[model samples]
Target chain A: MLKIFSTQLAGIFQNIEKSSEEAVEDAARLLAQSLVSDGTVYFHGTDEMMAVAYEGVTGPNAIPSSHFYDEKTALTAMDTVIVSARFAACEKSAAIAGAAREAGTRTIFIGAAEKGTDLDSLPYDVVLDTKAVRGLIPQDDGTRTALPSAICGLYVYQALHITVSEYLEEI
Target chain B: MLKIFSTQLAGIFQNIEKSSEEAVEDAARLLAQSLVSDGTVYFHGTDEMMAVAYEGVTGPNAIPSSHFYDEKTALTAMDTVIVSARFAACEKSAAIAGAAREAGTRTIFIGAAEKGTDLDSLPYDVVLDTKAVRGLIPQDDGTRTALPSAICGLYVYQALHITVSEYLEEI
Candidate 1:
């Protein structure tokens, strides 16, 4: 079962790498610009997705971010916020994206692009599809285990990190 | 590069699943017992690996844990501390693992078992190898990009989550 799941994940990541390459590069360009301009980059998300934000902030290009449960965090015009979500269909993510837009802050969203979801209407400047594979693994009770969004989000982050590094070097 | 990296990850995860099966299962059983007995499960780590702790606390069968940067948080005798580290060679992880052991709290570590490292001497009751694959991807500079420990740590968390859920059902 674990082997099957790992293989499925490898396939999912490859698909995402192909499909989201342009968007990921675009996001890295924007993020690199923000960092070079001395603007703070904030990462936000709920539940397990918060790990993406936490991981981003602690890495080499350290950014400022909010905690998973800290919904009261304020945004500023000079800030660039990256919001990661499993479905990108939740109220909290929408609220943050909406508020960031209103506050004249740039917003980049990374998550599953579920069809017919309100995420389409959110005011994000960039959207990197997490490409979550639903029903990826069939379980004993007839249900399927969806791939964890954190891994997908982290993969995207890795791409962004590499591109951002290259962009920084170019600048 | 991404495709090759993903394939390497799948193989690494499979190896971890096979080699660490008993230890992962053992940790799950202990964690399940703790949850059933109303004991708090605390996840801890530093830097990127901190995501593992945050991920563990936010998911279903949610546990109580401290943030990686919050070194002041106190633990109790009834608590269980799960520490995730890339190298497991840092002072903070060592300190936390040691303190938890002295406090009579069970400690479980998830990270690479670097040969000849102090990790072998840590006070963890169980150590699930993150099995970080060194030299997995060769760079232009002739250095290999070690597989990110965060991904391996998250994979272990997923395994533990599944096994714990099963154990919970049985109990």
Candidate 2:
């Protein structure tokens, strides 16, 4: 079971790699601008997706000037905000991104954009898909389990972190 | 760079799958005991490792009776606490597990046990190594970055979640 899970997880990671380069690079550039301009990059994640935000704020290689997004945080056009969730259907994340974008803060949305979900219609500066719309393992009850959104989100975060670091080095 | 990061991430996941099965099952059984006994299973993590605790507490398939560990939360023999960190050298995680054990709570430790680190010596009910002691990507300065402790931690959490679900189904 774990072997299968690992294989499928590898597939998800590969999918992100194969398709998310442009988005990742674009996010890095937008986020890097904030870092260079002394504007903060705030992160928010709904539910377990908070892992990704926490990674941005406290990971060993955390991006500089990153903080967890707060409801009271006042944003400016030069700032950037990232909102992550297991699925793009999360209204809270969508609302937060919507509000942030309206404030002229660059917004990046990260997670699985499932079919028929309202997440697809939401506009953001960049959207990096994890491509994990459902759990990888099949159970005896015919339901899927082991939906690892946090892992996928963290993978995206790390990729973006590395790209941002590279972008900073080039500047 | 993202390609290299994906490949290295896959290797780390494979390493955990290959080597951490027994520990994962042991951790699952220990955690399951708390669920069956009407005892709370508390989770604590240092730094970005909090992603694991958040996953356990707020995840869609969160284990019954799981909560984020609070310093003030009292424990009993029936209760279990899982502490995670990026490396075994995190004294804060060790201290939390030690105190929990002293209170007669079953304790599980999760993270990478780097060679010659104190984490290897700290005793717990189970130690699930993430096999991610260093960052996967090397930099121009010959240093490594992209240390994805949270991603590794979440993978372990998902595996344990699946195993515990299986264990409960068997019962």
Candidate 3:
């Protein structure tokens, strides 16, 4: 029983390593640097995905900085937009995408890759495909349940923030 | 200008001091220790309050010996329900609350005052009522906007967890 338990502990650590794929973290740094270098970072959240954004934004942990939203320099120059999967029903996301296009601002969507998706293809300077990371998980009850989505989403947030911090060093 | 800024910070700190309440924390501590000491602790969040829950629950940070919703325990002693205001519209929260009640478990609603709210007729568990936490700030342009609700909400969680940890010492 003792041997089994110890091996089980080691197995968990190995599984965690297998579960982690970080192709998007380095890309996220470029996106952050690009936005900060230019002007503003516009975050688009659908439903509760706002929590991920609230962490990166300055002032009031929940609400994004109004100053960043209001300033013209932030909007026109380096403003990078991040869209979340919760945008399935959120029309506001599409509006932001359209407005960004009209204004020539850069946009990134952490969403699906269905063919011909105009928003999906918008030269996403950094796309941390969270769903693809989820796909890499072994077929199991936990993955099908809320565990994978919940865990991976938080992991993506950490990866992106690390990339953003590195991006700041470049500037 | 600097003096004025110092005064604002002082006021914010004072506001938090005045509003800090702790009876709910005491109650929750006893509650968590009682259940967790035995076997498991179950949570059912209501409404938008689900956001508050996803963090301390099945997420990576919180390690539960076993997932509560995954199976049924035959002990019949497990009971403790955490309700939030946002649960009113959330079916998932409602279902969990219902399950706990049906299983002959105790329930606690960490939200605004209800009819049976005793010990302290507080709206929210001490911190929210006393915390400067998430008030709206007037913009220079004439509009008003909220800071961050989670920042304050997390403060409440911290206070509650501290008390709960102490309660565990007894069990």
Residue lDDT tens for model 3, B73-141? 442445454544321233454455556656665544443222333523222222123132332444457
Arrange candidates, best DockQ first. Answer: 2, 1, 3
Q: Write the per-residue lDDT of candidate 1 for residues A1-171, one digit (tens) a residue.
A: 566667777777888888888988888877876777777788887777776786677643244332332456566676678888877676788788888788787888888888776654777888888787474668789877646688777777777766676677788
The interface root-mean-square deviation of each model, in the order shown, is 2.8, 1.1, 13.2
Off by over 4 Å in 2: A118-120, B118-120
Clash pairs detected, candidate 3: A38-A78, A39-A78, B19-B130, B46-B86, B46-B87, B47-B86, B47-B87, B48-B86
lDDT of 2 by residue, B1-171 (tens): 878888888889888888889999999999888889898999898889999889989987687898899889988989999899998778898889889989899988878888887554785889889888888888778988888688888888888988998898888
**TM-score winner between candidates 2 and 3:** 2
Two-chain DockQ for model 1: 0.46
TM-score of each: 0.86, 0.96, 0.40
Residue B4 deviation, candidate 2, in Å?
Answer: 1.2
Worst 10 residues of 2 chain A by lDDT: A115-124
lDDT string, candidate 1, B56-149, tens digits: 7764324433233345757666667888777767667778889887878788888888877765577888888888837356668897754567
Q: Which digits, one per residue and each the tens of the lDDT, describe model 2 over residues A1-171?
A: 888888888888888888888999999999999999999999998988898888999988788999899999999998999999888877898899899988999999989988787654885788888787888998778999888688888888888988898899899
After TM-score superposition, the amount by which residue A32's alpha carbon in candidate 1 deviates from its true location, in angstroms, is 2.0
Q: Report the number of the highest-DockQ candidate.
A: 2
